[model samples]
Target: MTNAMWTHGVEWLTAATPDPRAGERAWLPGDGTVLMEAGRHWDLVSVPRQLGLLTLDILWYDPARTPGPTLVDSAAHRVGFLVPPDPAGDWSGEGVRHASRGAWVAVPPPHRTARSLEWIVPPDACTALHPPVTLRLALREAYETLAVLAPVC
Candidate 1:
């Protein structure tokens, strides 16, 4: 990856995990690990809940492709992974699971990790969900912000 690509990668991480002052909240456990496949990037985040845990995933894909939304079902509470537009591929469905506390689930094949922890985003605080169209733009903005803030970028 070029310097620019590395910058974008850093930005992607920062955009996914910002300070509480920047509206970044601890929605999940285990922090998160980023995945890059096809042409887009994904953050498998763990969010905790009373009943169970939730994985609040976010994807950044090209807007031109306009991919469809993906639905995920977990054992505890609701698990959702937003599928961003990408020509590469879709990382949704069958990937959702419980991430509450110390329990760790095996990471399915085609994914990088052998196993990972899961969690949920606190439902009450996450109200800034934009429409798909707007989210695409926000994704871009966050990427840019990350590029500017990242040290290695």
Candidate 2:
């Protein structure tokens, strides 16, 4: 199947501030937002306005029979996949893998029920990572495509 286009509006959760010790490693939220644009496939997105232009790309993964959604950020060099905990035992798959740091970061799932998952990559990282696209026009085209594909309820 051909790739699908999508647009999502995101807001910064924390104000951008300078870090005293780390030079400029300020924590600004809503970097690149990842969403499931298709069945079992996810998209890493960097919206416009924060940066000069918008950018997006699909994360490559090996298709599995029971694959949960996977998220990837080329800029961050991070890849994470959700693995539901087994009712009788602990989850088996790796949680978070930091490519550059050369380590596997184990992230425990929240105790509460998880309806969805979100991964935010830094906007600057995204800009540095992916090429730009005309987001407004893409969003409009995506809307039209969805309207055509929507099922009758």
- Give the winner by TM-score: 2
TM-score for each candidate, following the candidate numbering: 0.23, 0.24
Q: Each candidate's root-mean-square deviation in Å?
A: 17.9, 18.3
Give the Cα error of residue 59 in candidate 1, in Å. Answer: 12
Which has the greatest lDDT? 1
lDDT of 1 by residue, 12-42 (tens): 4334322322212222223433222311223
Q: For model 2, what is the alpha-carbon lDDT of residue 58?
A: 28
Q: Candidate 1: where is the Cα deviation over 4 Å?
A: 1-80, 83-115, 122-130
lDDT of 1: 0.30
